[model samples]
Target chain A: MNTATIIAQEIPDIEKIRRDFPILDTKVNGRPLIYFDNAASTQKPWQVIKAIEHYYTNLNSNVHRGVHYLSQKATDAFEASRRKVASFINAEHDYEVIFTGGTTESINLVAHSFGKQFVKACDTIIISSLEHHSNIVPWQILCEEKNAQLKVIPINEKGELLMDAFKAMLDETVKLVSVNYVSNSLGTINPVREIIELAHSKNIPVMLDAAQAVQHMPVDVQELDVDFLVFSGHKLYGPTGIGVLYGKEKWLNQMPPYQGGGEMIKTVTFEKTTYNELPFKFEAGTPHIEGVICIGAAIDYINEIGLEKIDRYEHELLEYATEKLSEIEGIKFIGTADNKASVVSFNLENIHPYDVGVILDQFGIAVRTGHHCTQPLMDIFAIPGTVRASFAFYNTTVEIDIFVAGVKKAASMLG
Target chain B: MTINEIQDELIEEFELFGDWMEKYENVIQMGKELPVIDVQYKKEENLIKGCQAKVWLHADYKDGKVLFMADSDAIITKGLVSMVIRVLSNHAPEEIVAADLYFVDRVGLREHLSMTRSNGLLSMIKQMKMYAMAIQSKVKAN
Candidate 1:
């Protein structure tokens, strides 16, 4: 989609959306709840919650085994969820989507299965500095095991990936390139389309960790032409245990099965066993049935409201939050990427993020205060952690005002 | 009789120690108020993991009520531990489970704690609950 057209489509009604998430209505510490932990996991809407409750209360049975009505209903619903996930990301076929325990497991599945089969000694894998540990560690383990070289694409102080550095890293020996579509720590929306195209030009497979990006904006795998795209359900207002790993059909067919288990197998024998096709080959046991069903409901909810709407509202929230947070004395905002998501990771001068988080909690404001699983990124900034206030479509300008006031109070107390 | 009443009594008792900032003196004073656990009950099994400060909790179930004794190496945490034990101790397992701790905000201690210490408090409560659950399960098993 054209950038202008995308922006125009992305407007949301913030107050109306806030009501969908029941947890937002409660008090955290006597004060009203101000949830700023959207990046970690979003508060679930009624639709997603109802979907889970309905599944267990009505169609509670193991899928793909029994011919009984409950089992068939369960299997049909589960498969329908798979189809919904496939269409959500604009995958060519439903089989391209493999469900796992979230983005971490999705990345690990590719590393263990695809990496083991394809990556060999002397090969290279390229990753950016802004990657979450999930994106970085899996490749590091894979490279270490295969005796492959891991090349890092450096980021500028602004937290944007150096396209020149990325281009320089690419070569014929580069087996894979993995980068996050949006940084979890910095909220930098990476130019992933260019990165994918560059890697593809070198005939190297590209995997984009869309764990953070999928919530912020629409992810069209076909448009990007990425070899792999992975995201978690919880980050998108779904249940925690479910995640999606979208790979090209050719890659899916070529990679070996991740785990040997009942559901993933065609037959069981003492000597050898054949694996099931595409998704079933990767998903190993009786999966997180309720979580998967809830993810479908989440996707339906997002679709009905529209990704464009959510994206526009979140962008406004980010800009407002950034301006307000920047105004506070002794506050230094990190990751000043021009194009960014709704996260404002910052540190108050001389005050630990933990201390800042504690005082904020007194005001019933919940913000993430840690490395955000991006330790390498923390190392780049030469800090332990930042007080991260990540926004959602439901967040408001007034909430940002409250957050700023709370931050000001913390500063005075700590100072 | 109720968690709030116990909390009120604790606030009244804690005021005798003076400022909350003088945590070390407060700890010593609070320690004096703490009823002693049996010497035989003090063991490595009572220790909590992941706390930078040493904490030991011992519990005994009598007449379907669970009584607990807790101590910590750090003063503020010890005071906090004492506060938790005051309400939780000498309560039935079911009563302890039913008690809502959201009123902890009223203590005004959360602002003083770092996020890690707050997490430790949460972990301590979870451990207490787990202990209660273990006791309940054992009774069911019997």
Candidate 2:
């Protein structure tokens, strides 16, 4: 079956799903809020919110060391979250999942731990033109430190990754390949599975930054056979300051600990220190306890709704938004990739992105403006930034109508 | 302080200028109403760094009060400078130091400003308040 037909067959009731998020009901500037900034962070469902409250009220304690009842319950809940995260991404074992602060820290952990251990002088690390600064800077720092070369896979004018360029960059010297599963700025859903397979054939390990991908579709780490995958909980209807860094057991075992502190260590003496097993070895110090538990609830909520259904509903919204937004005079849409997630970045003729954002906010329509942490991509386009409107499954065509009207208003006012 | 008081003065001022286009046309006429800064004071020290338009601000303390003179290359930005000077011109140093410029939102002018322009306005206000505080500190030391 074709992908579009499979997607359309599993459509969800978007309005019903929208009711689960309380923040969407609130008004901004005396108008009904039309949130289009889902790329930055998604609104939390009641289930996720309640999970956080429940943790604080009923099962709040430090994990791993204490023998108390609360401590045991907390540890079980914390470790249970790891299992859920593993299953969510279809990883083989829960031990592969290490909880970090967010996608930024997760990428940094791989760069510091895996890059430091595996990378050597004169080796190459390949990333794409569409990478977030979080993904790019870590490897740049690693390359600078280890005297390695940082190679980039170029993108087409449509913001699609040039697969040929990616393949050309891979050679015997290319030790690691890291790329985003979806471009946050452009919303291009990359051919990550193929990219991983190609890299692996060259004997290079691949890390996928799934920050923008997890919310849109199912991510099977085993099926892709990526060495590492990272995603933030907040981008998937959970709290901020919590994320998962899933690495292959072999890689995780070989790599050094990201941070050295209390919880990550098995035992510490004046003479020597031994690290904990699997996941705990990487998650050091006091972790984000409440945020971790809330992620499990978010996983449950998404699972109940089903990602296939969510993807369909969101694609419908994207299609509608794309059509409506295109009707405006002088509106230039960016990232016309064939396989895109639910984001639309664009610029209006002669109007600055900041001006567009301000006018939209007046109508209670929220959109992101500026480089979107992909200044390299901006440099590629030769523009400073684009006004980005990203959608979630819960968002409606009515909201898009309001958004279109707001954009028209901005165009008339500023243009 | 009331909307009516401000509206009345604004409308009267608008009537004298006829229309937005005519008022926009009469540059020298508008400059006649604007309080001027000394040419000697137009140094790099007075320049606001991030503005797309060239802007200069100078202030003086007189009779325990602060007075400001400001100008901008852009006409609309000059109007914004005039609005700021109107609120802050004759205020005492301590009062100026205490005043929260976020209250500009109440008058609905801030709603029209872009976030970048609002941030620029904020930076300018912060600098002015810093100058006021510095003068206050010097007075206390004396």
Candidate 3:
């Protein structure tokens, strides 16, 4: 009906793409479902869902230890997933990839093992204000145990990290720098390439919390020269309870095993024990086999449509939503960084975000409200929280229109 | 009115609404009309946990009846809080403790009473019942 809406409807074969996700066709509150919570977790396409059903139906066995046929089959499929993930992120080696419970565990693996190995008292670890609590809390725990100081790179009013402040904070005492490639709360695509290069120049390793970044864009770790990267599977349209932690082989070799169990060790004795090599050193247990394999299927799904196309389409949705939403009265847009992904965070004047979200939910629009596990970021904005509408490729401009209308109704009703 | 009678009255009133939006509009109006809690009692200790919106509930026991004052930063939550207070306030502690609170479901706002809602209506109800039971014990002691 508006200019932005008209332009965004031009993306081709969107209906076909939408058909792949059965949930997209489902109803919520007697209205057609409009899923805008992609930042939280994405809906699975039939391909990825079928991959899960297929894995359990045929290949169900313990990987890496089985002498039986099913075990070898499972092992081959699991290792093949590792390889797919390695190539998906362009990791130098498949052995460099470690499967953890989720992004939180992957981060803890680094914070615990890497921290135990390298971090000492008085050493500084730097993170950005835009980090989710997953990235913040692990470092806090690591710093607390190691008696290390954790520093934050402050952000401006627009939610963009101040690079000059980051540059000034870099020194010999700073051991590792961890920040998100894209802020989960703000949708700011951080200048990670620059951050990685800068940290590398100081001989400090950099870890990227790519939980919000990997699915939205094609992340080539070698191209970024990043020392470590982490992302969750569910966010990428895969099964839940699985995540990828990609570290340089050098760093993975140096860090001790994260957990002591059957899969992570080569030999065990009363007085002497040895950990397994590279990824097994960090994995520590039988991994989530279904999650691992189906995440590869999710990758295949993303590749089928291509990340660049998905990125472009989602960006269009973001722009259209932002434009349509701005037309409403007294609506304040939060996190207006120049570079953003498929997210728009905003607040209606004098109306609580929870109130807005409740109204929107009635209209069958699913958006995230509240701090989004980034309470510190909410404090920085000096507001209770903002209504966040995040998009995936399947979401269309018509849905955005309904969402905009719902928000306008909410604002007028609550104003 | 008795607790069941009050719940029946609420269910009757809610049945008049044609849709969820109209129902929500009524709730928002009720939120605007809610009696504000005293500023002194709006402290962190009185705050309800496990809610996206901050709900502050304070109770007063007088003449064997538990009177409640509640507020929330979010208007819809405040509205829900007001509905809760309307149902159970000015009742004997035992009656308040034993109230079924089926009106929340009968009125089609059952989702708010769900544990996964995070709106704190369920938590608020629990807190209010807990307060009443505590008062009931102290009254027996006297």
Candidate 4:
């Protein structure tokens, strides 16, 4: 077989990849489990899981403030994870990576740190309608506190951003332009390269919420020249409660520390306290050390498979799924962007998405249903929600076939 | 009929269906046959909070028996609530409050609901019983 065929066959080996995820073998309601809720959180492979167990068992120690052997080992592993993430996103400096609780905390960190230093009264923050509440709410709070205005770049019915509208809104008063690289609800991939270049020409810093994008495809912060990018580890098949916020060094140096605590201090006296340097300045308290170490393993896992191959396989899977699902009567897609991810959001004729979700779960298929934390986007679409089946590379065509049959069963019962 | 008898009847009704798909189809039919509640009572206060799907349940007492009228945005939730109403409604306030709802387990519905939906179902039951208690207190006062 040729190289492409070899990789294609290996990338989506249904039985082989299924073994990596222990949960996939388990039965749900007496049927083999079919997990399509990857966007919610990806299941961990043995590589990532074993790494976490290895940390807790052999190397459990506090990082960065101890002279003991285990402490040094822990600190080394923690910082090594930072370096791994730094290269994973291709950041210019290792110190540019700041560990936060998750994507929410990372966005809030930027909103606090970057907002305090640069944003002023009458300054406007531009975000898209497709943003998760994490992205939208922090900016809203920042705008409220700073006496600034929050402007939105609306999307067309297809869920793609209206670049012309975004261009019209771009002006000197706009302090920052923030948009998701891939929409969590719609799977629509925004033209982030163009978005960054557009804002850069106007001398505005751009932030990307890559929570959904980084795992599905390759993301290089340096290549995109994105000022700030944030993503959660759990969504990338790693442990939950740990995530990374990558900031450009220039911006990191200019912005203030997000939270004041034990590790984030350079020097503290009774009168005055100075904050620590980049990465440490933003990270406060004892971090999710095991989560960090295992995320590094997760990155290693992805690299072994190769992101380009994974991306190619997922695109084909999405194409196949879309074509199969389209044949169902009364089925309508919510997002139809030309550039898309492995997310499929749809609804049957008049059945509520929640009803569809319940029926699908009965058949051992998992999907997300509701506004998906993008209530405004749901409002824009005039929908309560869409039943979302988000795929990962490990998911196969056979599972997609099962999902179609499950959806058909749901439609029959609900319609 | 007594609440136990009513629940037994539902269990008997569901026992006829050989498979989950057929049972679910019957549940959907039962949900569709549910009477609509007054539009005004579908407000936020009457809405059940624990459910993933919005379920609004309104209650009233007439001739010492409690009446429950409910509607849900999701058909499955509606179906579940309709069953709850059928077993408990038209009973005396004290009997409604004291009644144990065993039909859910007897009919094999406990396994089908998601964690959130199961919690919602429990809360819906609790809310119905709460309505019964409140009605009993008022009748005692008068």
Candidate 5:
């Protein structure tokens, strides 16, 4: 199914769509709640929520194990999710999709399995300074374990990566390059396609941490020619404890299994054991069945509305928010990339981000404030943290106005 | 004044704010009024764990009273720590350790605070009481 037709679909009525998310209607601290924390986790739509409920109520069973009707049903739903994810990201085959806990686990799987098989002593792995701790730590651990070195691609004061620096880091010794498609802290949309093409020319593989990107945009893995891509289901408006790691067939065939357990095994003995095929080889234990199935529902919900429309809507909202918030006094934007996501990280007049966050909460606005698991990025900017307000499609411009007032009030209160 | 009496006083003071904005302004002012801890006491040992904001607290026992001096990089956290210091400072070590901090709930900070901040507040109280307890034990041993 070509998603281009989905793109052609008219934009959904924003208010009508907001009603589908029950949490949007609630109040916080005696005021109508305005949630701008979408970068942390997008709230689940009723469709995805009901999918979970329906699974637990009727089709509750351990997938790929039981001979009962329920188990078969569970297994079908589980694989269906993988296929849906394959389509969502435009992976060539469903076998490319491997489920794990989330982006953290997805990166760790590649770092361990791919690194163990491919990375050698003295080999260098390239990463950006803008990565979340999850993306950075796993590679660091891999490099340390393998006696390999980790090289960093530096970013400018505006949080945009220096592409020339990225190119300079690529060489024969550069075994792998891992970077985030969208920075979690600053919302800088890295030129991932260019990075991938350049690295591929050097015979180096690239992995994308799309935890923040996939929900807000359409990601085509085949078009980008990325070796690996990953995202968390919860952040995509699905249940938690589910994520996907998409690797090319050739890479999956070469790398060793990530874990040893039942479903992932082809055959076992007291002697040597054989691992399962492409995906199951990596998926070792009993997976989050409900989370997997519901994520399918999440994709369906998004597709029904069309990702093209969602991206356009969110872009406008980001611009609107940036303009509105820029009017405030002493507001320093952490990122000002030409192309960016919906995340806005800034500080108010040297008032601690935590203080600003506390005051905003009183007005029933939810904005994430802190390092945002990007401690290294924080170090680059030479501050403790920034106040981050991220948006989604369901959020309205009226809420943005309320948020502006909240920030002004928070700043004055802190003063 | 008794701890309960001081707490009641604070609750009454907070009641005048028609909305949360004014209440938070008061907190910021209280934070500014909070005495800073000596540089020597802002060690890792004085830092409270599991808080979003970095907080350093120090307590000294003088003339049968426990006095708390604290600092936080975040104004909101500083305000919360100051509230703890205000209720317990200049009180006997035993009274400082035994005082029930109902003012948190009465001023509605207990409800307003997120779990992390509330845990931080509890951690501050725990550290202050621990200091008082150590002083009490040392006094007896001497």
Candidate 6:
């Protein structure tokens, strides 16, 4: 069968899905909102929003300590969310899942705590060129403090990791390998499973920065045998300020607690303090209670629709967008990895990405335009930035048509 | 003409546009018409800070008036640079410094003034005034 026939088969009810997000019904700049910045943050469905409201209204109490009724209920829901996260990623144990502020905090937790233990002077840490600043800066800080060296895995012209070079970089000096599962800037899906296996072969632990991965694909920690994995809640159709750090139980036991705070402590004394165990050791303070519960709700929402369907639907959308956008004259695609997610990063000839972004905004089409926190990648491409439009499952082909028209208009006006 | 009169004229000119596209078309036209900055003055030192687009601005004090020349890599930003230069250029330092640029809002381009916009038009306006002030101080010193 042809491409059109395959794409036409068994698509999700996008109109119904759009209704689940009330913001999709709203207008921006007197035109209907065309939200294409899903790679930044996905819109919260009503199920997730209602989960937040219900938590605050009915169960407004602290977890892990209070003996009262609401506290127990809140704690139950919060822990339930943790369990949901564990199963969502196929982690071996629920306790292995630690909650933090967001993916940045999660990565920092691993970088600081793991760095304090494993990384030392003359040691090396391997990260990729496609990393967001969150991943790069944390490792850099750790490397600086420990007098360790931070090595970068370079990418090809197609924005793919040079796997041979990565193999050469892995040696006894390397303590950890941290890389993004998906490139937020270019949408290049890294061969993380191969990366994990290679790191494991050399006895180095690998941490997959799944901040841009979890929402788009099914990630299994046990199956991938990943040492550590991190992802943000907001990007997964959940609330902000909540994220997950899935570490192997062995690593969690070895690494120190990220912060010294109330929940992170087992007992406190003037002389010395004992840190808590497993997940709470990293949690630190009173967590984002509602955000945690709503993550479970968001997972439920995704599970109900099914990731397979969302993945297929979004891939089709990406193909449609790519085909339509390619028709525009003087347009150059930035990242064209053989395998990509639902993101398109490109630029019009002689037009700054900022100008395209401004014009698209005037048309009420939301797109991200900048270095995308990957300035090193931008330097490699020898451009300032690209106009990136990332799609979620709720976006329709009609919206893509309008987006293409907007780009055509922008090209004509600016060309 | 007074800075206020120039601003009023700009506002009147922008009033003829039908929608955002037309307004932007006019802005792009103005940007295209803007005189190119001198290559020497377009160096790193003249580039405006806090602009998403690269904007190089240079000011010269000649005949007791501040003459401003500016350019930007982006057309929209260059247009905004042109508009700002129109209101403040070729005028006494004091007049340019004291002028209120109400035409931005009147032309429905207040969004460009927001720090979040990152267009650097706000920074450009501020830089223009600072140039005027610096020139004024230098004139007094002389």
lDDT of candidate 6 over A68-187, digit per residue (tens): 999999999999999999999999999999998999999998999999998899999999999999999999999899999999999998889999999999989999999999999999
TM-score attained by model 2: 0.82
The TM-score values for the models, in the order shown, are 0.77, 0.82, 0.98, 0.95, 0.95, 0.98
Least accurate 10 contiguous residues by lDDT in model 3 chain A: A2-11
Residue-level lDDT of model 2, residues A153-200, one tens digit each, is 999999999999888888899989999999999999999988988998
Judging by DockQ, tell me the better candidate of 1 and 4.
4
For model 3, how does the per-residue alpha-carbon lDDT over B1-142 read when each residue is reduced to its tens digit?
9999999999999999999989999999999999878899999989996547889999999988999999999999899899889999999999999999999889998888777678877888999999999999988999
Fraction of true contacts kept, per model? 0.00, 0.00, 0.72, 0.64, 0.76, 0.56
Q: Which candidate's DockQ is highest?
A: 3
Model 3 regions lying over 4 Å from their true place: A1-10
Indicate whether candidate 1 or candidate 2 has the larger DockQ: 2
How does chain B score by TM in each prediction? 0.75, 0.71, 0.97, 0.92, 0.90, 0.96
- Candidate 3: deviation at residue A289, Å? 0.7
Residue A114's lDDT within candidate 2 is 88
Quality of candidate 6 docking, DockQ: 0.68
Can you write out model 6's per-residue Cα lDDT over B36-103, one digit (the tens) per residue? 88799989989886535888899888899999999998899999889989988999999988888898
Docking class of 2: incorrect
The DockQ of predicted model 2 stands at 0.11
Candidates sorted by DockQ, descending order? 3, 5, 6, 4, 2, 1
Give candidate 5 misplaced runs (Cα > 4 Å).
A1-12, B39-45, B111-114
Clashing residue pairs, candidate 4?
none
Candidate 6 ranges beyond 4 A from true positions: A1-8
User: Which tens-of-lDDT digit does each residue in B1-142 have in candidate 5?
Assistant: 9777788889999999987667777888898988768899999988886446778887777788887888988887788888888888889888877889888887878853456553266777888888888888998899
